[model samples]
Each structure stands twice: as C-alpha cells, then as structure tokens.
Target: MTISIAHLGPPGTYAEQAAVFYANWLVKKTGIEGILCPYPSIAQSLQAVASGQTQLAVVPVENSIEGSVTMTMDTLWQLDSLRIQLALVMPIAHTLISCATSLDKIKTVYSHPQALAQCQQWLEMFLPTVQLIPTNSTTEPLQHLENDITVGAIASSRAAQLYNLPILANGINDYPENCTRFWVVSEGEVEANYRMSSISPSHTSLAFSTPANVPGALLKPLQVFAQLGINLSRIESRPTKRSLGEYLFFVDLETDRSSVQMKSALADLSIHTEILKIFGAYNVLPISKDLI
Candidate 1:
C-alpha cells in the first residue's frame, strides 16, 4: 500500500521540502514508497491525517529564531487522533524573490509572519521603507506578483526557481542558525523501525492545564518534573480559549515517557493538573549541513 503524506504547499514550500526529505527517510527505513500530498495550510495538512485522507502529515512546530509556530502547536493540542511519529529539523534559508533584479526597486515585501520575523533585521537594514505584508504561507505571496517589479516575497530558494522569479537576495535571514523543527504525525501508531528505543533516553511532548485559577496553580506541575530531575527542553503557554486567565502549558521533556521517573512524575503531576495529554515520545533527527 502507498502511504499518502500531507504537507503545506503550492509547490516549493519549506514544508514540502521537509515532507520530501522525510519521505526519502521513511522509504529507506521501512521500504515503503511514500506519496506526498500538499495542502493549503498546516492545519489542513494535519486535518487530512485525522480525517483519513492521508496516512501521515508533516507540520512545523518551532523555529530556532522565531520561537514556536503557534498554529501548529494549537492545532496539535486540539486534534485528538493525531500523534507525533518523528521529529525532523530543517535549516531555514529565507530568500528575497521578485521579478526585479535590484533590491531598491522593491517597494513592498510579503511572506509568512514567521519568515518576516526571522528576516526582520535584514529587511530593516536594507529595505527600511518597504511595506511588509504578512501572508498565510511563505510561498503564497508568489501568486500575487502580478508582474509588479515592486512586489517581493521572502520565500525558499526553490520557490524562486519554480516560479521563475529572480532571487534578489540570498541568505536573508538575520540569524545564521535559523532552523525549524517539524513533527510527523499520523492516525495509526508507527512500526518498530520508527519507534525510538524505550530503554534509551528520548524526548516526550505533553500538554496540561491547571485545575484552578489560583496562585501557584502552574508551579505545582513544573515542580513535579523538577523534583524528578526530568529535564524540560522547552515549555510554552498558550491561551486555552475557554476563559480569561485560563491557559494550556505545552512542555517537552528529555526523558523517555515510559521511564520510571517520568511515569511517577506524570502521576504526581496529574494530581495538580486538570487535564494532561501526552502527545508522543519520539527521536529527533538533526538537519545535516548538506541538506541546508
């Protein structure tokens, strides 16, 4: 059977590149040929998996320069059937694409909010007077060029090649260490080859909310991990959308979820938390320099 994989795209998106990279890895690891299905948005790509339109979906979770991608995080928390299968890191190199060849000819710049934020310094230093507009996806702006030389898009280099647009600037991201962490989620559990060893230490992602709006409500859950010596790699708080002052905490711990210390800590944490959802436990793959 062919595995249908979904990703955000129009073609030549960073998400599409990630999907392709993971597809190759998946085939090498399992001998299964994977087909890539591109969707309009990250949420829709993930929804395709939950709705059984596809077997797997790859979505961005966080960026090294821009913190977390809020939509990916919030949607993952809301979707119950989807679980992370593996984590892949991709080096991000934002480029300035337009019909014109010179940077000064560009009057307006467009890109996804996250991409704009990552290239904030470079834009400010060079195109200080240019109008910065946010689009839904990074490459979505490419379709709006309308033969206008003043319109520019901050997108992937591959996007420039695909759209036949000239890359006015390269490596435009302010930080040289720009990278994004992507999560591969699916409706069914992954096979043994994809599963990280429970015996070895691994990364675990979970979301939880406090029982009440009282003082120290958040501190108690964190204390459980601290007391257990469980190292938290990342923690983010998102508005729960239920009420004012209510929020959900998403945490990534360094130990395997099946470990004794993690289980005990989670059990103790349950007493203090109103709801807890363990998303998944998986291994992380670093993006190679050649892949960038």
Candidate 2:
C-alpha cells in the first residue's frame, strides 16, 4: 500500500532527506513506496496523518543536543488522534551550503534558527564577524539566495544540489556528532519491516505536566524508574503554555506495553502527576547506518 509519510518541505530539508532514508528501508523491508509525503511543519504533517489525509507522517521528536521539540511533545500529550507506528533516529549532519561558488564571496549567512544553533561553533570559526540571517527554513534561505553571490545559506547538501547551490564546507555542526529522533505516526494499520517481537516490541512515549509549586513531584517518577531498572533514553521538560509557573515533561522509555512492568509504570505515573498520557508504541525500522 502507498503509505503517505509527511515530511517537511517541497524537496530537501533534513526531514525530507530522512524521509528518503525511511522510504528506502520500508521498501526494502516491506515493499512499500511512492507514498512518502513532505509537509511544512509537524503540526501540519501530524494533522494529515490524524485526519486520514495521509497514511503516515514523520515528526521530529528530539535532537541529541537540543532535547525535545515542544510542539511535538505537546502533540504526544494532546493529540490522541493517531498512534506512533515507529521511532526513527536519524543522525543530523549540517553543512555550510552556499549559493556562491567561492566562500570568499559569502558576506552574509542565512539559515533557519535551529540550523544556526547546530553549527554555531563551526560558523563562528570561519564567519565569526559575518552577518547571520534567520529565515523560516534552511531550504527557504537557500531558495532566497538564488542569485546573490554575497549571501550564502546553510542547509542540507541534498537541498544544495536540488537548488544547484554549492556546499562550501560540510560537517559544520558545533558538535562533531548531532542527531534527531523522529516519530513515524499513522492513523490505523500500516505495514513495516520489523515487529516489536524483534526488538522487545512493546513501547510508548509519555508527556505530562505538574504544578511547578509542588516539591519533589518530578522526582517521584525518576525514583520509580531507578527502582524499576527502567532505562530511560530521554527526558525533556518544557514550560507549559498559557501558564507561566507550570512545566511539562516528555519521557521516552523502552517497555513492552503488553507487559506488567509497563502497566505498573503508567499506573504509577498517573497517580504521581497532575496529568499523564501515552502515545502508543508500534514497530520501528532500524536506521540504515546502524547496519554498518
């Protein structure tokens, strides 16, 4: 079946590139293709999947350095319309892409804010005194720099190639290693290459918030995880919306939802917080690089 996988943008961005990676994996493993769709934002993409406009959608959940994306985290809590079919971890590698043929011609740098943060150190090394411009998306700045030799944009090399821009330098992230984990979500049944049974299958994501005034409310769950030997892969807290004094916590742990341990943890978490919700766990295909 053609599974609509919503990514970000028309052709090239980290999300679109990652979608290609996912498509290759799914086709090779499950024989599904021609359904990879790209959207502008997670909300738009996730909405499509939730509305049945698309069969599936890919939403960025976390960056290795940047933690969780607040909107995505919020959706995990508020949007109970869809279930997460897979968790994909794609390593992000930022490049110093430019429209100019030579680095000497680049006087101003343009990129999305997140890309700038990711490559802050590397950009500082070469363009410390240069002007930094923030645009809606990395690809947008690249598109805007079409004929301006004095302006360059940092984006994916795939984007650079698609736009016929040049990559002046690559591996420009401040950290040598940078990656983002995304969720592949869908409304109903979908085909995949792997099953939970292959990798201890049962899993889910929990996003919650508590009264900031309460003491030790946050500590309660961590204490439970420690006591339970639950290996937490990630935890990020974001300030609550429309409330200045509250905070929301997004946590990812590996546990088979069918197991007693998961049930106990969920039950305990429900009692420990003001609110808690689960985004269901489904099968996730292994990222390609993991094979090598």
Candidate 3:
C-alpha cells in the first residue's frame, strides 16, 4: 500500500527534504510506496495526519541554533491523535537565493522565521538595512526572486537547484554545524511494519501539566525519573494558555517507553500530573550531509 506523507512546502523546504529521506527509507525497508503531500505550514502538515488526510507527517521539532520549534510543540500538545514514529536529524546549510547581481543590490529578504534567525548574524553584517520579512515557508519567496532583483530568500542549496535560482552566497547561516531534528509523526499506534531491525528505539518523549501550581508541584514528577535513574535528554515548558502561571512540560528521556524504569517512573508520575501524554518512543536517524 502507498503511504501519504505530509510536509511544509512550496516544494523545497527542509521539512520536505526530511520527508523525502524518510519516504526513501520506507521504500527500501518495507517496499511501501510513499507519496509526499506538501502543506503551506507545519501545523497544517501535522493536522493533515491528525485529520486522517495523510498517513504521516514530517515536521521539525528542534534546531541546534534556534532550540525548540514552538509551533510544532504547541500543536502536538493540542492534537491528541498524532504520535512520533521516528526522528531524523539533518544538517542545515542555508543559501542566499536571489536574482540580484550582488548583496548590495538586495533591498528586501524573505524566508521562514527559523531560517532568518539562523542567519541573523550574517544578515546583520551583510544586509544591515534590508527589510526582513517572514514567510510561511522558505521556498514561499522563491517565486518572487526571478522577477525582482532586489529580493533575496534564505533557503537550502537543494531549493536553489530545484527552483533554478542563483545562489548569491552559500553557507550563510551563523554556524557551521547547524542542524534540525524532524519527527516522522503518524496517527494512532506506530505500526510495527515500519520499524527496521537496523534502527533501535532510543528515546521516549512525553508532555504533562502539573495538578496544581503549588510549590514543588512540578518537582514531584521530575523526582520520579530521578529516583529511577532516568536521564532526561531535554526539557521544555510552554504556556498552558489556561492561566497566567500555568504551564505544560515536555520531556525527552534517554530510555524507551517500554523499559522497566520508564514504566515505573510513569506510574509514579501519574500521581503528580494532571495530564500526561506519551508522544511515543522512536529511533533517531541522522541524514548525512552528502545525502542532502
């Protein structure tokens, strides 16, 4: 059967690249034919899977430079049916795609906020006076490049190639080791058919809200993991939106959800949390720079 994978696009966004890698992996591992469905935004791409419009969605969860992707985190918490099936870490190299003859000719720059922020230092040094506009996706501004010499967009090298746009500058991001972590998410339980023997599940992600805002309320659930010797790889908090100080905590454990320690920790954690969601345990695959 064919699987429909959704991603943020006008075609050449990083999310699409990650989805393409995952789709190719699916073909080689399970012989499943995968078709990509591009959405205008990350939230819509994820919503497509939650609404059953697509079988899976590939959305970015974190970036080495910018930290957590708040939109993805907030949407995942709000959507009850979606769960992460796998994670892909891909190296990012932002290129300046434009029709301008040189950097001095560009007046306005456009790209997704993350891309813009990733290259913030570079932009400040080079195009200090340029008007920076945020678009829904990196490739959203590509179409305007050919018609306007003064317009430039920050995007992937693959994007420049795909759109046949000229690269005014390469490696424009602030850092050399820039990368993004993308989640291959799907509705309901993660199918065993998609799991590969070569890949080992290593991380478990979950989110929760405390029963009360009282002192030590959030500390209770954390102590459970600490007592079990569970190492938290990452922890982030987002506004619960219900009240001023109320917040939701998202954590990534180094152990799988089915592990004995994790099971014990969860049992103890339930007592301290008002809501707990297991976003699922999944293996992480790193996409080599050459692959991109």
Q: Pick the candidate with the highest lDDT.
A: 3
Q: 1-292 in candidate 3: lDDT tens per residue?
A: 8999999998899999999998888998899988999998889998999999999999999999999999999999989778888889999999999999999999999999999999999999999999999999999989878999999999999999999999999999999999999999999896766554465579999999999889899889989999999999999999999888899999999988899999999999999999999998898889998888
Q: Please provide TM-scores, in order, for all candidate models, with all chains considered together.
A: 0.94, 0.89, 0.97
The worst-scoring run of ten residues by lDDT in candidate 3 lies at 192-201
Q: Identify the superior model by lDDT, candidate 2 or candidate 3.
A: 3
**Count of steric clashes across candidates, in order:** 0, 3, 0
lDDT of 1 at 265: 89
Candidate 1: residue 152 Cα off by (Å): 1.2
Residue 188 lDDT, candidate 1, scale 0-100: 59
Candidate 1 lowest-lDDT run of ten = 192-201
Assess each prediction's global lDDT (C-alpha) against the native: 0.87, 0.73, 0.92
List the candidate numbers ranked by lDDT, top first.
3, 1, 2
Q: Tell me the tens digit of each residue's lDDT in model 2 across 1-117.
A: 656778777677777777777777777766767476767777887888777788777777778877667777676566676777677777777778766777777799988788888
lDDT of 1 by residue, 1-292 (tens): 4688899988788988888888777677777778999899998998999999998998999999889989888888889767887889999999999887788899999999999999999999999999999988888889877589988999999888888878889999999999999998987566655434344537889999888988899999889999999999999999999887789999999988789999998889889999898888888877685764
- Name the lDDT of candidate 2: 0.73
Model 1 spans with C-alpha error above 4 angstroms? 144-146, 193-201
In model 2, the clashing pairs are 7-39, 196-201, 202-256
